[model samples]
Target: MLLDLLKLHLCEACSMTELHEAVALGDYDLVAEILRTGRCDPNHKDVDWHDRTPLHWAAAKGRSELVKLLVDHGAQHCLRSDVGWTPAHFAAESGRLGVLRTLHSLHAAMDAADLFGDTPKRLAEIYGHQDCSRFLETAEVESRSYRRTAAMKGIPLDQRDEDWEVKKEELERNPPYSRENHTSSAQKKKGKKRGKQ
Candidate 1:
């Protein structure tokens, strides 16, 4: 396995990490082997892919076993991408109900919102993933409940990404214009043109 990995590394000029490649390819055995080696950080973000971790890939691919393996190996469930999307968001978008269930069972953050204030539930709704949306509706409530309980019990929760918080705060301080604003302005111009005609 090591020889195969070494040969792949020597041959491929891709910048993505071996772990990322394995997860992206949905190679369960290869992923397990990589995790066992303990040489790679499971939480290492692929900058080329908008700072997405291996866990995000597993969730997006709906690999329940891979998701379990990654989390068990100390992958941070709260890690977000460049756009502040958690693994839950990807799973919801792709209608990965089993992946969502697996993540919830593992105590991963299910109610986290992205930079655009879209929760996993919202993404499920937008993507017409009824099953995922329904599951997320209850999961969101349960997630909040346990999070509050953990806080009161003084149990540390790995639900917040500190770096993302800083970036979020910065964005809030100097917020950019929303796409809605652009669309509204275009609509108003069209209305005025129609009235003139």
Candidate 2:
């Protein structure tokens, strides 16, 4: 069975080693081939310290093609390594503008914080990537103001007002799931039980 063969031949650990080698040698075609087969998990980290993903290696080496391939295959852009660095952070720190652009186009969250609460935007500025820093600023602004419902209205970009409402009837028609509400109810129940005690 192909699945069985893949399981037997595709060592997650070995894939990391191969990924490092491919990045070091800049064998993007070979990297793509390996990734296409679905044998290598692009999100896998090295066994040693740092535990960097394939995206990390490709970004650090400025291997834009390899980085794109890994991202297209569902490599997590938001994953933080042991050193608290994401692929975008690495790209910015290494001055890999191409990799940074690819990541941004994919909607990789520019403001995603790592363990130290440092976002890629901060890293870009700190690393002196003026273009990347500017892109991150624009991305953050767009995210804060743009709405999918408003986008459906086909309003002119220059004329759209912040006060435009989606309609209360429409909002009432589709009440979104509230996990917070559920958690609050659970907390209330716990509080009542504690009071009874």
Candidate 3:
């Protein structure tokens, strides 16, 4: 009851143009309406204000719905602020573990470091958010493992790695390099025997 009343009260005082405010205040209705109507660019950074994007605010405040909505509307998940801090940095400092997970799922930069050389996970540990810290540590390890394997396989580190492998197998079934060779040694041997017979 109090939260709804607060939202109503906050929305009343906010300008329709301030998408950042809407995200910070957890006003999903306003955000959805704006995105649906194309009233604003979801990826736009606030130049005159804090220089952060709507996704940044949503992540900082632990607003999962807003973060998901912003990303769905084509927000740049890995965009950095003036201080080189990304949305992940904000989420970690505040112990927003679920927000961190959501950002990672959206392919946000988990390894981005701020001007002080502190990554989101490092900041989480420094700020005493143990769960967020541990989560990021695990995520980092998994990401490194995946990247190393992808490198060894000589494939791009993209979400389409599995699809790439399948496509490669399909291509290898009729490899162009072997196609120009005319025939294999087995075929040559069979031709010689047939000719002799």
| Top candidate when judged by lDDT against the true structure | 1
Query: Considering lDDT, which of the candidate structures 1 and 3 is the better prediction for this target?
Result: 1
Q: Where in model 3 is the C-alpha error above 4 Å?
A: 1-17, 145-197
**Model 3 per-residue lDDT tens digits across residues 13-103:** 5333367777878999998987876656665566554457788889889998899898888777756665466788889878899999998
Worst 10 residues of 3 by lDDT: 157-166
Whole-model lDDT per candidate = 0.84, 0.64, 0.71
Candidate of highest TM-score: 1
lDDT of 2 by residue, 1-197 (tens): 78946753665746366766676578988888767776567777675736677878887778778877887787776665653566777777667778877776665655555444566677777656798788778765554355343467874322221211232234346545453444322234346767998
Which of candidates 2 and 3 is the stronger one according to lDDT? 3
Ordered from best to worst lDDT, the candidate numbers read 1, 3, 2
lDDT of 2 at 87: 75
Angstrom error at residue 120, model 3: 0.3
Q: What lDDT is obtained when candidate 2 is compared to the true structure?
A: 0.64
Q: Tell me the deviation in Å of residue 142 in model 3.
A: 2.6
| TM value for model 2 | 0.64
